[model samples]
Target: MNGVITPADTLGTRLTGLRGFYRAGYRSVLAYRADLLFGVIGFVIQTVLAVAVWRVLYDGHDEVAGVASSTAVAYAVLAGCIQSVVMPWQFSSLPQRVFRGQIGVDMMRPRSLISQNLAQAAGTMVGRLPIGVAGLAVGLALGGVQAPRSLLDLFASAVSILLGIANIMTINLLVSMIAFWTLETGGVMILYRFASAFLSGALIPLWFMPEWLQPIIGRLPFQAQIYAPLSIWFGTRHGGELIGTLALQLGWVLALFVLLQLVWRRAVHRVVVLGG
Candidate 1:
C-alpha cells in the first residue's frame, strides 16, 4: 500500500497544483474580452465624472476638502482606474463549498487550501494588472494629470499599494476560512464588502468623511486597504505618519496570518474533507 509521501513529493505536488491553478486563473478574464474592453471604457467614463466633480469643487481656489486639486485628481483617478479593475471580489463561494462539500476534494489535495486559493488570486491579479496599467496610462493621458511632487511621495504610494494588497489578501483568506466553521457566509461577505465600500475610501476620500468617525473607523484594517495607499500616492502623508501607517499594516499582516494558521488547524481537526 502507498503509506505516505516524502518532502520532495509534497513539494512537487504543491508546485504542480499551483501551476495548474495559476493557468486556470490566468485564462479567466480572457474568456470575456468584451467585458475587459467594457471595463476600460467604464474607467474612462469614471475619469470624466471625477474631473467634473473636481472642477465644481476647485472653482476659484486650487484646493478644496483640505487637499490640493492635483492630489484630489490623483486619488480620484487612481480609485477609478484601480478599484474598477483590480478591486477584490468578495466571493462567498468558499462558504458554499464548505456547506455543500464541494471543497472536500480540494481539501484532500497536498497543498494548503488557503495557500492554493491565494495562489489563484495572486495569479488572477497579475493577469488583470497589465490591463489596469494600460487603463492608468490612458487615464493620466486623457486627463493629463500628475501625481505627488517628490520621489518620496511616489515611493510611499507604491509601498502603500503593495502592503495594502498584502493586508487585503490576509484579511480575505481569513474570511474565506470562516466558511469552514459557519455556512452563513453571505451575510459575512456582505458585511465585509459594506465595510470596505464605506470605510476604505474606495468611493469617497477619507477627508470627506465625518470628522467624528475618523478615530473609530480609521483604526479598522479596511481603511489601510485603500485610503492609506492612495494618500501616499497623493503625497498626503510624510515623516512619522508614514512610518506609523506601515507599522500598522505590518501588524495586521502578521496578526491575520497567525490567526489564519490557527484557524486552519482547528478547521482541519474538526473536519478533514479528505481522509487523514
Candidate 2:
C-alpha cells in the first residue's frame, strides 16, 4: 500500500513535471537579456506603427463599415500586441529537435512531449507578457486603445483570449509535427504564418475583409485565435453573438487539442533516427 501510487499522486507528479518544464521555458527567455530588450523595443515600434496606420486609414472618417475609427485603431493596437506575444513567426524548436534526432531524448522523458511543449510555450508567453503590456501602454498613451465596454465584456474577453491562445498553441504543435516526416518545415511555416496572420485577423479584422472572403475565413478555425477575443473586447459582437463566438472558440480549442494528440501519436511512430 505504501508503494502504490494513487491517482492524486499521479496527477500531482505530472503537474510538478509540467511546472519544471514551464520554468525552464521561462528561464530560457531570460537567458538572453539583450535579445529580450531588443525584441521588446521592436514590439513597441510595431505597435506604434500599427496605431499610426490605423489612424491614417481612418482619417476624416468617423465610422467605416459600422466600426468607428477609434474602435478600429484600438482593435489594431490590441490585436498587434496580442499577436506579437502569441503567434510568433518562428516555428518552435520541435522541428529542429526532430531533424537533429534530439526528439528521442524528449520522448524518453516520463512526461508526454505534448504537455511539456505546451507548458513551455505557455511559460514563454508569460515571460513575454511584459512586452505586450508595454506595447499596449504605448497604444493607450497614444489614444489608440480603448477600454473594454464593461466589466462583463472584459471578463468574457479574458476567457476568450485564453481559449484563443490554447487554440493557437494546439495548431502550432500540429504543424510542427510535420517535421516527423519532412524534417524541414521552413516553407510550410512561412505559409502557415501568412495564412494565420491574415485569416486570424492579426493584420486586419474580418470586418474589413471582402464580403465574399468573409464566409470562407469565418468557417476556418483561425478566426477563433485573435478575432473572437478582440471582437468581444471591442463589443462588436455582443449578446448572443458574443456567446456564439466564445462557443466556437472553445470548440476549436477542444477539437484542435484532440487532433494534436492524434498527430503526436502518429508522429512518434514515424520517428526514425539513423546514425545518431
Candidate 3:
C-alpha cells in the first residue's frame, strides 16, 4: 500500500484541501479589515434608519399583520445583520474572473469549483462576524429590538440563520454562473440585488405584504434566506411551523445544490466551446 491512496484517503485529502480553501477565504477577508469596519458602520446606520421608519409607521397601531411595531423593528435589525454578514452580493467572483479571462485558469484547478466557492463563502461569512456583532449591538442600543422569546426560539433562529446563509450562497453561485455565457453579468447582478432585497424581506416583512403575495413569497428561496430566520427569532414561527420553515430552507439548499451542478456542467461546456 506504500505510495498508494485509497478512496477513503482521497476523500480525506479533498476535505483537507477544502478546509484550506476556507481558511484562505477567511484570511482574505481579514486582510481587508478597514473595509469591513466601514461596512459595519454603514450597516448599523441603515439598520437604525429602517427601525425608525417602521417605528413611525406603527406609531398609532399596536400591530400590523399581527406583528407588533417593536417586533418589526427587531426584524429589520436582524435582517440587516444577516444581509451584512452573508453579503451574498459579494459572493460571486466568477463574473469578474470570466471578464478578465482568468476563469479558464480557475477551471483547470483539480478542486471541485462548487466546493471551493462554498468554502470561500463560508470563510467570508466567518470574517464578517465581528462586523455583524457590532451592527447587532448598535441595533439593540437604538431600541425597539426584543430578545428571543425562549431558548428554543433562539436555537431555532440560529439554525435557520445558518441555513439562510447557505441558501444565499447557492443563489449567488447560480447568478454568477450566468457569466459563462454572457461574460458580462453587471445587469444580472443589479437585478439580483433588487430582487433579493425585496423578496427576501430585508426591506419589509412578508407579513406586512399583501395577503395574496404572502403565499407566493413564502414559496421563494429568498424568504428562506431572511424572512424565515427572522420569523423564528421574532417568535412568529414556532413548534411545527418552525420545523416546517426550517425544512423548507433545507429543501431549497438541496434543490439549489442540484441546480448548481447542472448549471455548472453546462457552463463549463460553454466555456470550452468559447475557447476558454
Candidate 4:
C-alpha cells in the first residue's frame, strides 16, 4: 500500500487540488462584484462607440479594405467580448507579491507557482464570464452582429477563443516573471497592453491595416488572439484558413509554455539566492 498508488490517489488528487485553486480564484473575483459590474459597463460602452464609428465610416461604402460594414461591426462587437476574457490584470499582483516578500510563502505551497497563477487566472475568467455574455447580448441586440455562417465557423471560433485566452495568460505570466529581474515592471505592462491591443485587432481589425503591415502583424501572436477568432465568427475564414489560424494559435501556446518554464526556473533561482 505504501509503494503502490491507486488511480484515485494520483490523477484524482491532482484534479481535486486544481479545482480547489480554481474555486478560490473564482471567489476572489466575486468578492469584488461592484468592480465587475463597472468593468462590464465600460466594455459595453466601448463596444457601442466602436460600432457607431464603424457604421458611420462605412455609410455609403460597400466595403472597407475588403471587409463589409456588417463584418467589421460584428468583429468589433465580438472583439470586445473576447478582450474581456483575456484580461491581463488578473495576474497583475505577481510583481507586487514578489516585492512584498510573499513569493517565499507562495513557493512553499505544494503546487507550482505557475499552476497556481494559472488557476487564479482561469477562475478570474470564469467569474468574468457573465460580463462577456452580457457584452455579446448587447452586441446582438444592437443589430450589427452576424450569426455564425456555418457550424464549422462556430466551432472554429469557439476553439480560437479558448486558445486566445491561453495565449494571453502565458504572455501575461511571461511579463510578470520579469519582476524577478527588475522590480519596476510598470513600463513593461504598459507597453504590453498597448502593443497587444493594437496588434491583436482589439482596436482595429488587422484586415483594415495597410497591405505592408498585414504581413508583419500576421507573424505576431497578437492577431491570433482577437483577430483570428472574430474573423472565423464573421465567416471570413473557411476550411483550410480556419484550421491554419487555430494551428497558429496552438503553436504560440506551446512556444509560450516552454518560455514560461525556462523563465520560471531562472526566476526561482534568483529568488532563492536573494533570500526573497
Against the true structure, whose TM-score is highest? 2
> Per-residue lDDT for 1-276 in model 2, tens only?
689999999999899989988887678788887888888899999988888888888899999998999898888888888888887765366887877888889988999999988888888887778788889999989989899989999999999998999998899888988988887699999999998999999988999999999988887899988988998898777889888889998888888988888888777667743432
Give model 2 RMSD, 1 decimal: 1.8
* Clash tally, candidates in order: 0, 0, 0, 0
lDDT ranking from best candidate downward: 2, 3, 4, 1
lDDT of 3 by residue, 224-262 (tens): 999999888878886789899999999999999999999
For model 1, the superposed segments whose C-alpha errors exceed 4 Å read 1-17, 90-93, 181-184, 269-276
Error of 1 at 149 (Å): 2.0
Q: Candidates' lDDT values, in order?
A: 0.73, 0.86, 0.86, 0.85
Which 10-residue span in candidate 4 carries the lowest summed lDDT?
85-94
Model 1: worst 10 consecutive residues (lDDT sum): 84-93
TM-score of each: 0.83, 0.94, 0.92, 0.94
lDDT of 1 at 126: 68
Query: lDDT tens string, model 1, 104-203?
Result: 7878787778777777666666666655676578767766367667888888778888887877777777777777777677777778866776787877
> What is the Cα root-mean-square deviation between model 3 and the actual structure?
2.1
Candidate that beats the other on TM-score, 1 or 2, i.e. the better one: 2
Give the lDDT of residue 46 in candidate 3. 82
Better of 1 and 3 by TM-score: 3
Error of 4 at 14 (Å): 1.5
